[model samples]
Target: MKKNIAKYIEQFEQTLNFSDLSWWIIDYKNDPGYFYCNKVMANTFNLDINAQKHSVVDTCPIAGDYIKNVHLASTNKANLIIKEYLELLNQEKKEYNNTFPYYDKNIDTVKYFSSKAKALELDEEGNVSILFGLIENITSKETLSKELKEYHNIIDTNVMTATTNTKGIILNCSSALCNITGYSKEELVGQKYNILKHPDTSEKVFEKMELALAKGEIWENEIKNQKKNGEEYWIKLIVSPIFNEQGKIKAFTTINQDITDKKIIEKLSKKDKLTNLYNRAKLDILLEKELQTFERYETNSSIIMLDIDYFKSINDNYGHLIGDKVLVQIASILRSNTRITDFVGRWGGEEFLIICPNSDIENTEKVASKLKDVLEFSDFGMKKNVTASFGISSYKENDTVDTLLQRADNALYNAKENGRNTVELIP
Candidate 1:
């Protein structure tokens, strides 16, 4: 049988160009020392080839300890690879194929290789006598695999991820996704991903989303979804279509994050709790932007300052509850009567500020007058129609926040002196 194996080796050498590839053989008579390679590997590793036919552990200096001592310190990956290869031998498998990294001592470089091995000859009792293998370098592919692993690691840490079939059936989901959705892997797999969808999100939005995915484009948007407990949440969602080797859609991968807290904070920061109008902070921001627009482009923008007439009397007589209701009613009227380009805010208690973009002093006064009429006609629960005094000021050249506000306040004092139910303009 040994002679037959030698003849097969001779025939293989003659049939194929073996010079370019690294080849090896093993007798399996010993442990790690049983492995042996040809003169090519010997020269590559600066080892003696003649002694490889014998017990390499006894002959070559690095044979038995090569995997441990030579592989890079980070993973000791070569040792693991060799251990798995030996386990395959114990399985009575006739062929072996695996890829792993190794250290080449002669060049002092770490190289990735695919090793393919097969039984070449059998001894008596059906034990293996000779094993042959071919090793090919694959460093570039291994490097890319390593980089992709790192990229996946980063994404896994930061995002909840899931994969669904083209039919929108869930295939797999990360632990983060399961955690956020209050579902287990057992419960999620094989379920339709629409289980998380919000009813308020129209079917048309989903149609557009699916259309984009069909075209192999990534879809990104804010999505409202329901959790397992029937609680709704907002997510910054991204969906990407995964294609098979044939360039056909195989699946879609989704990554998303909870943005419910962010949306709530933004809404709270910009709105007043009592009147549902914009808050003082938001009013300041809008005013600054309007002033900036006027400075840059000479756009006519104006501010209207209005104070609820005798607000303290309303609180003292009708109570703060009625005063709050009056404020809410006023905010609703302001929102209903003003152009969409105008913004209304509760600048402070009993003081409302309005920002009107592209409005001159005349248009601003007209807006103020219209507001006065609306307030005068609107009834308070006190059985009397409530009224507000208005002061209008258009943007002037070289105006700061303080100067603009001062002019409006001075105009408001004039309105109060002139008996409170009128629009006073500062030109």
Candidate 2:
């Protein structure tokens, strides 16, 4: 309302577009008194009425020459209308309405306007004193039509985005979304948002997301989604709820950021660089978790600490490169022969640790014994068979990680004392 009343009137003109009044007022004998036009007036002429009581019209760009050149044609026509307003006042007409085309110099555009002028008060001779005017911008309707087409083009040029109904049915998806998901717009639209959800994403996770969104909160999560080719990919998903006038849920919008490479790198970080088995650090995390499980439940777990017998001699004879290959072979054998519930890790050079959850001392000994027989028999592509000595210890009641590991290390020393390729149990 402050900047240019004309522009405000034009913007809301759509609601009152069919209505007659986009109001303006003028002094019958002077400049345009009070004028209001909507966006069209701003777009066309950059026209503004001065704060003075006299009806003076000014063009923006504040420079004298640009203002004079820009508003010259429209200002002259408006002044002529003011002269006519006075004549109508003297003729005693209540109001006069008409249409005119103006050449707008700002953007070099041609605009059309429908205007109605009314006499406010009359002089002693019954002459018109002040005049009221209403203007409807007919050209702005065409301008809005052109703007909408350009807006649609701009929106589609960005990142992967999509929209859906309140019930989660897909309404539309961008081409970028189609390219990433390997689905066409035809295939994606009308489908539920879950069409791309992976089976690994549990229903509980979806329920939690739905509950958050229902309360009008934005929900963000990393989703493991399946592509059309059945290959899995990772994405950071952000969903926002669209609200209607009545404060009711209208629809939803989702933006996706592809994070497949990041997830792959994170997985590699937890693995041993040489053997690709988990490194010692990762093994410690799993071990602590197993201990926590034992603390909560009375169920037992065990650990096996082992190292290759005369591994330095093997490295010396065949070179460290061959030593690494032999270790990788040993690691492979350990991985293939162990149960899924067990964990085998490369516990530093020439050493390995096996975590056996739900296993007692007797059961742990059997596992280590099996690993020993495999190491003794498995071919290492070397002149002699490689041997590994294992020390087994099970979790005792209220035992800490340090205590359990110390007992296993002690037992491993005894296994070496008792000779290699033997499984020794801690008391």
Candidate 3:
């Protein structure tokens, strides 16, 4: 039986020689030294690779130092390390697991190692006497993780950063994000990330983001978000997936830049300075979008084109200043009478365009008639009443922006020929 046991031990040592892991056996009952150690294990402690026995604690001071130094990232992790050490010392558990940083004499640098050990023999008195263990060098992996954490820390302090779980729950956030959003870190953490979602953002935008993230792809876009004070802000947001060792997405990190000022500038460029309404260029874009919506979704929409009656006479008689005031007043009336969803813009000269999305000709005629009545009754401080003629055109299957505007212009001419201050619809 002793011969068979020695043969088995020899086979185990040979097997461990082929592995990168450091393997060793300790005889606690007889010598308090390693009964056998493979080359990797002996080389790790700078001991004799050919030696059959060595004092475990005398030669491996690194292990003793590791147990004495308990600096860990968190209290919970420190406690677990202590528990693992106690389990190994008492030999109460079937298996022991631990990781520690130790100064390597051979390399003259601190390195990290992971260890797994189990009891291999029992003494006559039923106590554990022989222990087998393996140690693996994990310095590269641990160093990379530490470097990544440092990078994240720097970004979180200087930029708007936030991290979320797969379920969209906010896990962590930066002070910059809290400052920009007007929320406290305590209030934002553990909350769903959508608390800042603005009502004006379409659901389709969020759907697209979700689909891309689910495929572990980065998503980037300009998003309009609301603050705690109900003020709207814009952000150019980029979201990246964080992967685990298994190459599966574990979380998402978002980096954002405030773009509200940029958005404001773009909006100003699209507006008419005189009346504070969308300029003709913006009107063209709105018209095209409405037409595309109709073609794609089969949703009906209409445009109302109205021209001030004899507007050249007003500019000549009232001076261009009073004419400008009249134009501003007319723009205000259009804004007040139309739904928020309607796009009201200055078409050109004395003409204004109102694009009513999801509205048919009948509903659009009602809107035009309401505006005509309002203009006729409202006092523009001019000597005489100022009235406007209205023309309406619904979007057709093959309608383009040019075709739609041409039809509306024709309808406006018909209204002017019939008698001013009336509304007419051209199908």
Candidate 4:
């Protein structure tokens, strides 16, 4: 039986092709054992091929005590599988870590087995043998598993993270961060995030950013930023400090959301759909702002309320198409004639209001007369010309926006009653 076991080990050694595996068989009752090793295993410990004998303990130096424990367990009729890691010298005298599994039974210990080994079996005649098994080095698989776990962790992080230093030089960024600033990863990696700052953003915004960052307090705000194409956008930015091991702020992590579309829809809600001009709702808001400015600065301002003359007749004569065309033309004229700072909005059907800031009754009348003359000569795709009646009212120190609008409206009614295509001032 012993000779047959020795032949089996020799055949296994010749068949096994891997260079990292070693095997040994131990007699259950004795400390010394007959060991068989492959050419690879012999080369691993720089052992001579012709060496007459070798000890399992000598070959696997670090796991010597673990092997003895398995041997003791095997002699006690225990079916045991033991696994351990050992540092051993290789062919080049270099130390390498290797894993070994041992199976023990009543008669013997089988050493340097594979992780697949379960237990050892003893024949009725008392010969011990390892169950069918094979060893495969899985170091590469273990290393790859560790690396893949790390990669997944990097992908799962939520920091809208641009890798920028304190000087605002960007390095790397996460996809969430890239999506917010309207920049692609390639475009933003090396550039400053401040490139998205809008001209309308005040110094106070920067002051707040610096103050909060200096105090290590994360800052959050709904801020306006510009896109790569010079289009303005808004985002809710939350900037937090990224600290180093020294507890010093190394970088700032900023998370942002694109809110420009929402803001635009909000602004559009305040505008007239047909004329694309500010609606009455927005006019109310603007009037209050203008009135407050006038009160503070003592600025002379006036309101001009105008309505198209015979507009219903035009719509009746030439379908609503031409009526719409006339309205759009008048809107364009108002927009063109008003100063950039002046407010022009559609008050209602065929009626429009103009707020001329820093303008008195004289300038308002001049603007109104100009509008009248322009409309009187303008063609609305009809055989004849179109005109409008203008009513002007100067803002009183004690007057409200509604009161000023009402006075202009009253004058407009007086103009339509007296004559069409003329300007009238509220008494």
Off by over 4 Å in 3: 1-11, 33-36, 50-52, 65-86, 140-198, 201-229, 233-262, 272-276, 279-330, 337-427
lDDT of 1 by residue, 1-427 (tens): 2654456456655654357566766656434355555666556555565763545564332334354555353345555555655655664566767776566656777767777777766667666666677777678899899899988877765679999999999998887888788888889889998888988877787889999999999998888898899888889899999999999999999988889999788879999999989999998899899889999999998999999888999899889898899999999999999999899999899999999999998989998999999899877667777888999898899899878988998899899999999889886
Quote the positional error of residue 354 for candidate 2 in Å. Answer: 1.8
- Name every residue pair that clashes in candidate 2: 6-37, 6-38, 7-38, 10-38, 24-133, 31-55, 32-55
Q: lDDT per residue, candidate 4, 1-427, as tens digits?
A: 3344456566666776544655443332232344445555455434556874456555532234345455433432222222221111111212223344343333354333333322133445643433223344454665576689787557535445555677777767777665555688898878877877898998799788989898889989988887777778788888888899999999987767667788889878898988989999999998998899888998899889999888999889888998998899889988988889889999999999998899989988998998889888876678978888989998788888878888998899899998888899983
TM-score of each: 0.57, 0.57, 0.53, 0.57
State model 4's lDDT. 0.70
lDDT, each prediction:
0.80, 0.76, 0.84, 0.70
Off by over 4 Å in 1: 1-9, 16-19, 26-36, 49-54, 58-63, 70-95, 98-101, 124-127, 159-162, 172-219, 224-269, 273-276, 280-344, 352-427
Candidate number that wins on TM-score, 1 or 2: 1
* lDDT for position 86 in model 4: 15
Q: After superposition, how far is residue 195 of candidate 2 from its true place, in Å?
A: 7.6
Q: How many clashing pairs in candidate 3?
A: 0
Better candidate by lDDT, 2 or 3: 3
Tens-place lDDT digits, model 2, residues 1-427:
1223334334556565455445444444443433444443343445443322222334321122233543534665655555665666667566767655555666676666666766655556666655556666677775686588677766565567899998889999988888888999999999998999988988887798899999999999989998888888999999999999999999999999899999889778778988988888899899899999999996879999998999999988999999999988998999998898899899899999999999888988888898899999988888799998899888888798889899999999999999888999894
- RMSD in angstroms between candidate 1 and the native structure over all alpha carbons: 7.6
